[model samples]
Target: MTVKIAVLVSGRGSNLQAIIDSIERGYIKDAAVNLVISNKADAYALERARKHGINAVFLDPGRYDRSGYDRDILKLLNNYDVDLLLLAGYFRILGSEIIDAYRDRILNIHPSLLPAFKGLHAQRQAFEYGVKVAGCTVHYVDEGLDSGPIILQSCVQVLPDDTEETLTGRILEQEHIIYPEAVRLFAEGKLKVEGRKVRSLD
Candidate 1:
């Protein structure tokens, strides 16, 4: 069975493009990107999706409250019968309704190794904290902000002179790699979340 995936993005969607490329190259075994959703109408992600001939829609977050936004998102997901929801740089803090509706079906990629920097400016946070190691996290989306069950993480060493942009650039390379790997694991039924840990079954 092909796992139907819907990706939500609010930016350039480098991770989204990685997933799409992975599917095209058969790296993600039985997964298909059904649709791409963006809260900003001018998000470059939509253009990326259009270039790949994938269905893309923009739902204005400003028009709706949190509950209404979730309702709209849920409706869109159901319309496509999407089995998996991927958040790649999606900037909104999802409400409980969205989390409850999708439960374990929703996934997100955060820039910093989670539990360290839960909210925005993660790269900057890492730099400010003076952590030598920084990385990205792929996790199940939950009610808490970036406080979800961990799926996969890839670490990158922070150079002594690294700025936020430099650190983010390095982390993003790992993000492109691991995000697709995490999605592939979900599609193959290889990921099992227990407590705060995610076990990958071969």
Candidate 2:
């Protein structure tokens, strides 16, 4: 049984590419990236999807209210028969319409070990806060801002001389690894969310 995936992005989608690569490499099985949706018209993710022969979609959020925009997106997701929604670099907070509709089926990868520096600029936030460790997390998206159940997290040490850019680079490396790992687990039916905790079963 292959899971139909719809990837949402807002910018250059390196993580989206990672997922595609993982799928192609057979690291993630029983899943196919059926569609790629971007809110920004100029997002490079759309081009990447087209290059790979996946359905690419662009929606102009400026044309509608937040509710209408998300409603249209929900319609597209339904039309494409998406089974899992992946947020690669999607910037907007998902509306309740979509969130409630997908629930745990919507997966997101954050740049930091969540419940820490959420919102935006998470790498800079950790560096400025003088944290000794920083990393990335893959989680289920809820209505709250990065307050959903965590699925997987990997950490990196903060070097004494690390700048924001250096730290971001390191964290992104882990993002590439863990995000694909998370998707693999999800595709394999190995992840379970019990309360606020997620268990990775073998």
Q: Please give the clash total of every predicted structure, in order.
A: 0, 0
TM-score quality measure for candidate 1: 0.97
Of candidate 1, the 10-residue stretch with the lowest lDDT total is 93-102
lDDT of 2: 0.93
Instruction: List model 1 lDDT by residue over 1-202, tens digit each.
Output: 9999999999998999999999999999989998999998999999999999889999988898888988999899899999999999899888888788888889999999988998899999999999999999999998889989999899999998889899999999999999999999999999888888889995
Which candidate wins on TM-score?
2
Per-candidate Cα lDDT values, in order, are 0.92, 0.93
Question: How many angstroms is residue 138 displaced in model 2 relative to the true structure, after the best TM-score fit?
Answer: 0.5
Q: List the residue pairs that clash in candidate 2.
A: none
TM-score on alpha carbons, each prediction? 0.97, 0.98
Error of 1 at 84 (Å): 0.3
Q: Name the weakest run of 10 consecutive residues (lDDT summed) in model 2.
A: 179-188
Candidate 2 structure quality by residue, lDDT tens digits, 86-194: 9998999999999999989999999888899998999999999999999999999998998999999999999999999999999999999999899899888999999
